[model samples]
Target: MSYAPQKRHSNRAKRWIITIGVFIVVQIIFIAIDGTFLEPSINDSDNVLAKTVRGVLESKLLTERIAPYSFPFFNLFLIVHVVAILIQALGDSISAIFAKR
Candidate 1:
């Protein structure tokens, strides 16, 4: 059996590391922006739709009597966003594994 060169193997490994690092950074930024800004604005009551939506959200059993403007939508958005991110991460990981081969 022939021995594989270590340098080439390490270089290929470095590419995967960089790819994973970039993926993580991008995900963090996406989560931060969604959590910090987009979600709050979506749930804000500057418009009638937002107020109606907030009222409906406040009537839920889990958040009964909670303030309508207290960012309740943040939790809902967070859960959905996290699930979506997980699915996307799973797909990316599978694709990366296949690509490495």
Candidate 2:
């Protein structure tokens, strides 16, 4: 029922909002940098590996590969790259939700 606690809570919420905003902005900048710079620098072997993975996906061989545990090294690298991106996105989303509260 006290107004002082309410005011403090409001200020804390604003600070969180600003922090999450900054985080999302930085993430967007980094994503742009990666897309524009890092993505193109991948070599021919990487290209081949990506193509092979795509072929496996199109052929519905991923399930079989999963069972055999014969994941190509390049495919594992790609999975790690994708998982890192997912983690970043998930962290940003969670921060935004908590900031909204």
- TM-score on alpha carbons, each prediction: 0.35, 0.35
Report clashes for each candidate as comma-separated counts: 0, 0
Write down the lDDT of every candidate, Cα atoms only: 0.57, 0.53
What's the CA error at residue 67 for candidate 1, in Å? 12
Q: What is the Cα-based TM-score of model 2?
A: 0.35
**What is the Cα-based lDDT of residue 22 in candidate 1?**
66
Q: Which candidate's lDDT is highest?
A: 1
lDDT of 1 by residue, 39-76 (tens): 43444759998888777656563264432233555444
> Candidate 1: misplaced stretches above 4 Å?
1-56, 59-70
What does each candidate score in C-alpha RMSD? Answer: 8.3, 11.1
